[model samples]
Target: MNRYDNERLSAIAVLESLRAGVPTRASTKALPDLRPNLLEIFKEDLKIFAGGQNLPGKFVWGKYGQGKTHVLASIEHLALDMGFAVSRVSLSREVSCHNLFHFYSKVAVPLRTPNSTVFGLQRLINQKTEYELLNSPIQNEGRYVHPLPALIFEDYFRTEGEEQDTLYGYLMGNPPSDFKSLHKKARGEKPILKLERKFKPSEHATAF
Candidate 1:
C-alpha cells in the first residue's frame, strides 16, 4: 500500500485503541499533543540518549486516571520513530521495580525496535559477529558493573535452541541454573566460562 493508505489504517487503529481506553503507540502518534512542552523535554532527552550519553531516569507522577501512562505510550512511539529501542512496562503485584534485575528482566524481553514487529533483541544480536560484539560499547565502555550479562550475551550467540533460550531467559531475570553446564553444552571444547567477580544481588542490581 501507499504511504497515505498506511497512515489511514494507523489512524483507524488509533481511534479504536482510544475508544477502548487503551492508549497505544499508534494513538499516541496520530492524536494531537496534550502536553507539548513535556513532549519536547522527552524528545531532548531521547536525543541526548541517542548520542550515547547516560540520562538520569525520569519519574512521571500523577493521580489515578490521569494521562501518565498515555504520555509514556506517546514517548514510546516517539522513541521508536527516532530509531531507538523501546520497552513500556507497568508495575503490578507480580512485577516490581524494587529489585533492579527483576525490573531488567521485565524490560529486556519486551524490547521493541523501530523496524521490527517482533519483541526482544535476538534478531539484532544474531546479526552481529563476535568481533563486533567484543568491541561493542556495552562490553568495552563500562556500561554495566558486572561482566555476567555481557558474557551471557556473548554465549547467547554461541548456543542454539534451548541453550540459547535459557541464556536469554537468564538475562531476563529468571531463576539461576547450572550455567557452567549450559555453557559446556554450547562450547563443549572451549573452557567453561569464568566470572571475573561474583554476582551479588544487592550490589549488581543496576547491571542492566
Candidate 2:
C-alpha cells in the first residue's frame, strides 16, 4: 500500500477500535490531515494546558461518522505526549453526566497516563510509593523524624489499610472525609500542618 492507503487503513482501524469500546493504542499517530480544523483547536487547548493556564471546558458535537471519536483519540494522544494524564469516558445511560458519582466512576475506569495504558491508578500509587522510599532517609536519627517522607507515607498509610481505598474514593469524586486527619497522619508533625493548610483547595487537590 502507498502512504495514503496506509493512513486510510490506520484511520479505519482506529474507528473500529472506538466502535468496539476500546482506547486507541498510544503508539497510534493521529491523522490530523483528516480533520485539520479540529486538530488545530485541540492543539490550542493543549497549549493552554501545557502553559499551566486554566482551560475552559469544551463540548464537541457531531453526528455519526463525523470523526468525533477520531478527534478525541487525537487529543488523547497529544495530551499524553504533553505530559498530562487523561481519561476518556463515553456518556451513556449508565454513565450519564448528570450523575456525578457514576460519571466519576466511569472516568476513573479509563484513566491513562503517558507511561500507562491500563491500570493507571495502580501504577500511579506504586510510582509514588517508590518515590517516597527513594526520598526517605537512611540514617537512624532522621529516618522517622524527617517531615517530608513521614508525610508521604502518612498519606499512603492514612486510614489504616485504606490508603488505596481512600485514593479510589478521591478519584471517584469523593474527597476524603477528614483532610485534616489525613494531613496530620502524613506529616506526623503539628508545626507543618499550619504551613500545609495555607495552600488553596485547588493547589492541594492537584498535589498528586
Q: Which 10-residue window in model 1 sums to the lowest lDDT?
A: 134-143
Q: Candidate 1, 105: how far from true, in Å?
A: 1.1
RMSD of 2: 8.7
Clashing pairs in 2: 151-186, 154-186
Choose the strongest candidate by lDDT: 1
TM-score of each: 0.81, 0.55
- Worst lDDT 10-window in candidate 2: 138-147
Clashes of each: 0, 2
lDDT of 1 by residue, 1-208 (tens): 4456876788878888987878977678677998999989999999999898988998988998788878888888899999998887878966787877777888889999998889998787778866676677667536678877777777788888988888878876774568888877766646876687888878876776
Report, for every candidate in turn, its global Cα lDDT versus the true structure: 0.81, 0.61
Best by TM-score: 1
Pairs clashing in candidate 1?
Answer: none
